[model samples]
Target: MADLRRVTVRAKTPSEKPTTVDHLKNLIDKVGDIDTVIGEVMSRMKLESRTESQMILSQDTEGSMEWLSTNISKINYGQHPRFSVPQRITVLLPLEALRDTPYLISVIDTKGVEGTTQRPDLMAQIEDPRTVTVLCCSFADAPGGVPLSIVRETIDAGSDAVSADRLCLLVLPRNDEALKIVNDGGDVPSDREEGYAIREGQIDQQFATDGLPGIPVNFFQVGADEPEDIWRWLTSRIEAIRTAKVERIKRHVAAADNLVTNADVAKTRQARHTIADTMAKAAERFRKLRPMVRPAHLNLIAEAKKTHQNSIAASVNRKGSWDNFPVAHILGQGVRIDANLRTRDTFVRIDEAIEGLKDDFAHLSDVAQFLENLKDDVEEARKEFLTRVALAGRNLYSPYLSQAVDMWDKCEARYGAGSGYRVDVSAIFQAQFEGDPNAMTATEKVEAQVGSIWEQIVIDPLLEAAAFEDEE
Candidate 1:
């Protein structure tokens, strides 16, 4: 009755899975100290054991993911708009390689930007034909070291010597003998033929037998992760010294300029004082001249008064004489009226002689006053000239005058061409009589039109003709 029936098992489809409503958040912990990671990776690569090499190579993906997760936290904390984790080296050597040979050198903590002046001293202490391998996070940091391409685009540049075939690589020892060599401050080997031997833990390797040639070397001198530290230190110190020298030169130049400026300022102040003094003297002279010139105006007024009185007196005495006449008959002689007028002419002639004498004196006084006023104006001008010379120091006056004359010439050229004749008649009418002036309502407009036509027909032609005549 218990019949065993074969049950058919079918594969489940993707749609058959149940969706969960619970929100389970996942996040990886962040890594720290990218430099420390780089150092650790480099140290692992330099391992001589095959077992360690395989282990290090296999951890590449996991290490990279961890590094990314850690770097993300740094990005969020730094709050950078654009951030990215830099590409790094993971696997150092091939997995199947029986023996792990870290073909690279690492210099530890060179702190290149400092202690440049003491580089030669430090180099003197090192032994001759020393194998120095520089290790850096990027090959660009090592200028003369062998580059190992352990990751994508990880190598930037390396030294030609290291790139050549046949490199002597050795692991530095931390044993007492190695410490003794370091402390002794003596040479390890004088030549490459007698290369040094590395005895670290159970691994002992000897280098410096020039038997193999043309094999480009990848050296691993394990120490630290610095690239060109000595060179950087020397260069930075040299730059500091050079900068100091430049600053000293600049200070000297600035001091010289200040001296020259002070001298110029002193000269300018002296010149200004001299100009003020000259102006004062000229003003005093002008004041002295002003009083001497007052007699002319007084004499002119007196003469005018006397002439009017004489004319009135003659007009009253001569009843039929033409002594007083209408202004309209000024140009023509009038007919005689009587004999009494003839006798009166003799007295008028005598009076005229006296008047002539008075006029001569009055004219001399007017001339004297004019000369005095002219002298005052000339003195004022002279004072101004002296003031300008003293204040501007005469050296710059010619250029100043030239510029002034040029500006004046431009002004004259613009305004002296009768351009003012373009009269806006409405404005003129409004200014002259306002809207209430009906008597000569169209006068301004007519005059403006006539003037424009006159200028075109007569003024322009005459000017052109004169210019042509001058040319001829």
Candidate 2:
């Protein structure tokens, strides 16, 4: 009627190993039944049953250790029974026991244990096993006092295990020599310390060893005489393991957050750069067109002036009568003869030229206004796009850039296939050449010469440069 919970204690005794059997028997008697002791210990810690408890007894000691077997069976009655007394405890030659026990508390005694020499093998068996192996040994009786080489090798094996946190080696030395040997040249006192009388020190091995270096390993100066102290120390160690696990979780969470943050920052910077570069190119195009405005206006004015002069010359002519007439007769023309005179045709030609000039001037004025407004529009768009970049953090850069590109597309559509100035030229030609034969001839000449030059010098180059930049 014990609260076994998720606890298991196996009493292992290899055949003919009387010392091993005796040691387990004595420890059981002192601690009461293994099941009862574990349940009580868990209760003290206020832990509930998270897994089933198991008690494994080696078949080698089936008939040999009747007293221990009967007591274990009695204690484990009515709870989950993993095996019968006669059933053999698998030596776990494969270390399968380590893997199977999720929260294991293995109590191993090296001196009289069957697999003591294969310490490395036992440690290596743990494949990231989350269990604590309490390797108890009286180093004094460790075949030739457990050579430091074997001790180091065992520690190394445990460290190299997949999960070092899951392995803990608790050295319970019987005497001074054993304690000193296990200390492995450290400065811890050979005598007992305060509290648990457990001198908690770290394995003095290099960090290159697989396990985290400097994790404290408890060494009991007093042997089985202080069972309570030993149990208390073991409990504290378990608590430490739990604490370390929580800390690892926190670290992992922080690492994940940092990775996400870095990604966002990088994307934002790239988006910002793309938008800024596009705006800069657009502004530069506007700057280049500003100087060309004056030349365009002058060309229109010149064409208008030539048309007006030609119209006047063709209409007005002083004939031979004027040459024969004296200066007085010319001045008094009415008495001599009325020679050269303004005709209706002359008046009409002059009026037509004047109207053409006025239309040309109007076109020029409209173009000037369009250019000024275009500059303002571009500046405003640039400002708005940059403001979006500033407002939206790096995470939203892509969306903002998409919006800016959409706006630019609209501008392109409204202005011209590629630009506003190109559209302006087309509009001017339409206005100047409509319904006038002479103007149409002039327009064809301007289109053949000026249009080709504009495409070669301005439009084609701009597009080509933009294409090249996009490739990069």
Candidate 3:
């Protein structure tokens, strides 16, 4: 099966001309002169019938006379025998004849008397709205010493008729001297600068206009001996144009996909959500711009998806450190301990364990910061527990209670009270735990144990002390 993405072109031959001696004779009988007869025949000719190729029937006597002589043999026998006839019909065949293609053709007609301004009827034949028009003429050839002013006027008139995008004017210079004359505007002060001032000066300035599509007038030498060289040059240019168009489309699609993939790799929910929204809008734009997606564009999308998946895997691995932290195991068992000194000691060891895992927090910085903040909360809770224990002993009228109270006061002065500690370590950790199964499981386990420990170690002892005081 043929790949739908690849553009294909089928070969085609030029359609045969319908002009015959009988047809020309009939037109000549009605028309007085051969020029009128030829004009009538040309006007009636069905040149538009062949959509596959662009035919340029040049009326320039110098360039196209030989071609006309060889093709139209019946023209010689008429009343205009051995008269100056146009030569060389230039044809630009399309890559795909079925498709509307951009084709440029030039026809130079300098058949008028010297010092007289005239436009050829052949210029009228160049009215295919679908194709781009290029009027090309060189300063090398001038019949009967025709001045440069007349030639300049002719070129200026042709270019003025068409829009910049659809029309291009190419002026070929025979030598370095002719090139200089063309560049200096050739004694004609006109707004239309030479599109391609070839050989010496730069034409880049002429095409630098903002918002207007560049009308290129390039200067290049055409060798009579090496005609194949010019054909190769033209073919290379056509291929370059095609390649540039394809690459431009590919670049736009790739840029859109890359933005979305980068957003997927972000750590924070707000950042990720914001960027994802942008990506969605970009994707919509791409879809509208390129409705028929190519295989190359699909490949870019696939690569972006693969990159996002890889980033997710890396993120999961980084979060494993938090999941494996033993905060829950230490607090769960320590809360049930009967001895006050031992319970306090267990918490000190838990603090040490948290401190030890600091290096593991490199990949997961937010989780590490939460753990650091949790240390301050734990210290404040310990100070409150110690003060309550001292109070409970004093209420029982126990000996050494006075000394314990003094020690509690000193500890409070040194470490500050737990009431002012308002850091939300659990909330911070929960933010990281969302959408992650292993991390959520670990967080739930730790939270359940921490809740149990807070009630048992901190609340239960205070409640028992209050009951004892009431009984006295």
Candidate 4:
């Protein structure tokens, strides 16, 4: 296998100037103008029908009306006169006067002579005041059950409102409610409808009435090509639109760089403060958890060291001496020798050490398992506790058997029944005769003879009885 190379590339900061006040001023001015008419419609829409001009204007009682009126006149004459308004008691300036009254801004800008598809971008520019009732009427719904007259009226009226630009009529077949609205209004009863449903992403092209073929045909056709091809084109078109948006953002940012203000400085300071606080909190939590993690890691290290030392000792003993395997030695007159029982002691020591190593290994593994499960169990318990607290409106510090059960499960997973977690105790005896497999030590030979007698007296009888029991 070839070694793979992966390198992370970082973006370089562009040499750009800070936003200027003029740029913010322009954005604010345009946004304010859109907000004005939206405010009026919100204030009076429920009171009157769509055909009626909404009228619930509050009077401005503050000073500097003269200056404001002059500014309004300049703006009205400055741009397209039909779209711009003179400083009047009209709803078009409500946002400009919002200090004295409430207002709304159209998410979509439908007033301009542009296609429906272009309006979402304009809406995206405006911040939602969270007061508007956004209706996503799809044209596919036109064929299902929705009355065409009602749909047309809704569009016409919404478009006339200041916040019409904010209206998000999806014109997709997905919205069953939209289909019902349009299909019902048709001259002939609708057979079925198709298109994307507003609440769900899947196409709601299935029509209840037979007014239209499907959502793609009735709505979102784009009129240039087949619906399937158009859908494919739209996928790429949406990406291009997103790319274009980046350029628009660049332009806005460039413009803003020409202007600066104390409010902007304050906002920056507040953001930095928030980031610092979050980082500090994270650091504090990690510091608190360090003590808990350290003990478990140290225990694991100690267990591993013990196991390594025992393994080395067992290996040394296995290859170090052969005195225990040979016959007993005896000498008289100034020197004496006898069978070495010390060898037996060494074997016992090896067995003990091996047992300890295995026990420690199991303990360490248990600890690791506990740690692995600790986070999830704690989180789950915390959530359960929190939920109880919410329902009872108090801290519930009751003891739980559930946590005990979880600990048991963790233990079993790591080391339990048939886990083969036992120490390599047989290694101690095997080590004595390891060098020469053909030859047995004195103790091994005696043990083998004792084993033969014991098997006849105990093991053979047990085996025979067990065999007879099975036959019965």
Candidate 5:
């Protein structure tokens, strides 16, 4: 299958467009026009469809004959790790949906992203609701009325091939006849209401009528007495469509196309029940733990941060004995970044364990034990690194005499504090390291400091006694 990650958003083709992308790994950041709805939709899709799947070292095994499979199914048969298809939807609006430019059937071969604004005077001349083109063409270019069959086939999909991604919006002018045609439907009667009446070549239908067998239509009167009426209608529709689309993609696309046994599907389908059952039990177990985790590493980072700050302040003041310490090199570059990596490694182990459970792992007890001990792996790694850093900190980072600092030899409450915020070290690392590391910049230092604060304060306190044992 073609990789769908890189999505393109532009004005429907044969017209001036906003953006374009053909490759899966590309992004066109600057929209040709930022003010339009298309621009908003484009930006929103890109943001929502962000994925971090990396290329795996596995190969496609489609052509090979297999009696049975090993770990190869995980590596070989499923979605190729390197070619992650991003989930996205590019809404295609009809020209009248534009509701603005091209008063007539004239082609808009505009040079750039400008001149898209609607002319109130020109627009007012004649929006004879009788004159809307089928798709993008003007009334003059072709016949006007939209076929109700299009609605039944797509939006009002009562039977097969659900267009779960579309929301049909028929925008008519104020006090226009077409508005009544769309908004009035009880005249069709009960028996006839079951299906769109075939008139000439197209099925005749109304927008407001309840299609007894399908979803009820909603109306958002633009000039409603309540100002929030329009917003309420739009927001509710957006959320409902979003939810329906998510379910459709999960059930129809993600689950249907991927390779797996029926038994595996049943397991995944029932996974929510498994989670629901274990939550209260897990909470009770956690509540019984003694002497919870503390983030002593954050304290070490904070102390290092303070030392770095003092050095900068002293240098600026031309004070006596200004300590030239490598605080950034030690804490900012070393410990903070390493903490993020440790968290990531811990997550990898967790993923492996979960994947193992997908097959109803024979060694369920062993896998459970491994999962339970995963966070400790992060703490152990942090302790070993800090020990070496402390020995080295005395010579390389002995900031002007204030208090003795022992990095590794700190109380177990610090390092043994379970995983702590280091469990989310990726965020902590990104908070500091995303941009240029201007070591001397005060803002950079503060970012690292805040990361440490979050690690120490927010994450560690959630289950404080997890890290330490009760002193009997």
Candidate 6:
């Protein structure tokens, strides 16, 4: 079942109830056990496991509303089905303002030509119900029923208020509250009115009156209907509404709308801060690697090799087999003895000491001094190793950087440079140290950019899920 939310609003038109009040009450009491009735609803709807649903009844003077919601443990299906994504399912009592309001309010621009106002809610959609009503109305079996116009007025008003694609529904119960069920099976209605009972005059009248853009609702009948039949009647409209709402968000995203925000932007950024073993986490990794990699001053492994201690054994000694992997390329890369390399944890230490001097020695002044007095090969190895690391990172991380650049380009184009999200991939990687106080080595900066892109890939989905759960 859908997760539920609650809110309170001021009451208007005291004691007046929505036209559909009795019908909803009847649906709620479909079975002797209310729990069974709710369970049936959950199964029928197949609501998203995490979607939030809120119902707003016209409030009382005490500033309270009445609603019942349930949380069902969802099975691990590939994707849960959705019904509707109404901002709020409001059962409003007052209809006077809606009845009086014109379908299209005429206005003039500063220039003086007259035209109608913008209505975003009615865009590119056909069967989405923003408002639904139940009223006593005419059908094949029942005569002398209420006019469809009465229910249309209130629901149309509701459609106008809610922005985005919308629809309205009018439900009519049989004049005889109790009657014989039809069609032998309760699932489908036959020999009686079941679904939309729209008249040609109604659609024509909607276009005639103020040239309203959308259709007036076609009514649905509740003639001796069972709960299952009603559920069938309603699900299509609800699903349509849900699809429209979800698509609206998608369309905004695809177009990179100016005001649109996404969970990915923040999630990707958070990945950088939260990850345990990042390249820039030098101090801790270096401390742990110092003992294992056997830095020059430690003299544990280097002293054991007496012959070439001046050249290859100057800083560190290799402990494990390189496994035919290139030596320079392997620096700073985590390798496993029984290598299952396809993992997020790539910082397992390469048993290389010289690479750490350029990357991690920033915090270790003693290591920097030690590097100054080293033989040419030892010092040159660190620089050559660092250059290779930077080059490989560029190859590995360019795609992530490209995507981040792309995400930001849309943002900057929409919001302008002052928005402070403009990214230039070339400039970041090409950054040089020319006396700027806040300068970073080009290699360090590349690691940062790669780190950000990594976060976006891994964290965005979790963030999006949280955001979905947070929706009201």
- lDDT values for all models: 0.28, 0.35, 0.35, 0.29, 0.32, 0.31
Q: In candidate 2, what are the lDDT values of residues 407-445, reduced to their tens digit?
A: 233323433344344334334433433544554443244
Which candidate has the top score in lDDT?
Answer: 2
Q: Across residues 1-472, which tens digit of lDDT does each residue of candidate 6 receive?
A: 2332122344567886433234335656666688886776667555554354432334342322112112111212212243244433323333331223322221111111011111112111221234322222343422111223222322332222123323333335455322333322444333434323223233345445643444324444443546555544445544555676676556445435322432244433343233213323432333221112211111111111221212221211231112221112222221111011221122223213324443554333333332222222322232233334324543443333333343334323433234222122112212311222222233345445334432343233222222222222
TM-score of each: 0.13, 0.27, 0.24, 0.15, 0.18, 0.20
Q: Which has the better TM-score: candidate 4, or candidate 6?
A: 6
Those runs of model 3 whose alpha carbons end farther than 4 Å from true positions after fitting are 1-135, 140-169, 174-217, 220-225, 252-472
In candidate 6, list every pair of residues with a backbone clash: 121-164, 128-167, 129-167, 268-456
User: Could you give candidate 1's per-residue lDDT for residues 238-264 as a string of tens digits?
Assistant: 344456457656655654554454434
Off by over 4 Å in 6: 1-167, 173-190, 194-223, 256-472
Instruction: Please give the RMSD to the true structure for each candidate, in Å.
Output: 45.9, 42.6, 37.4, 38.0, 29.1, 32.4
lDDT of 5 at 151: 37
Ten contiguous residues with the weakest lDDT in model 4: 329-338
lDDT of 4 by residue, 148-237 (tens): 222332232122112222222234444233334323224332322331223222223333232321222224423322566433433443
lDDT of 3: 0.35
The lDDT of model 5 is 0.32
Ranking by TM-score: 2, 3, 6, 5, 4, 1
Sort by lDDT, best first: 2, 3, 5, 6, 4, 1
lDDT of 3 at 51: 27
What's the distance in Å from true for residue 301, model 6?
98
Window of ten residues with lowest summed lDDT in model 2:
334-343
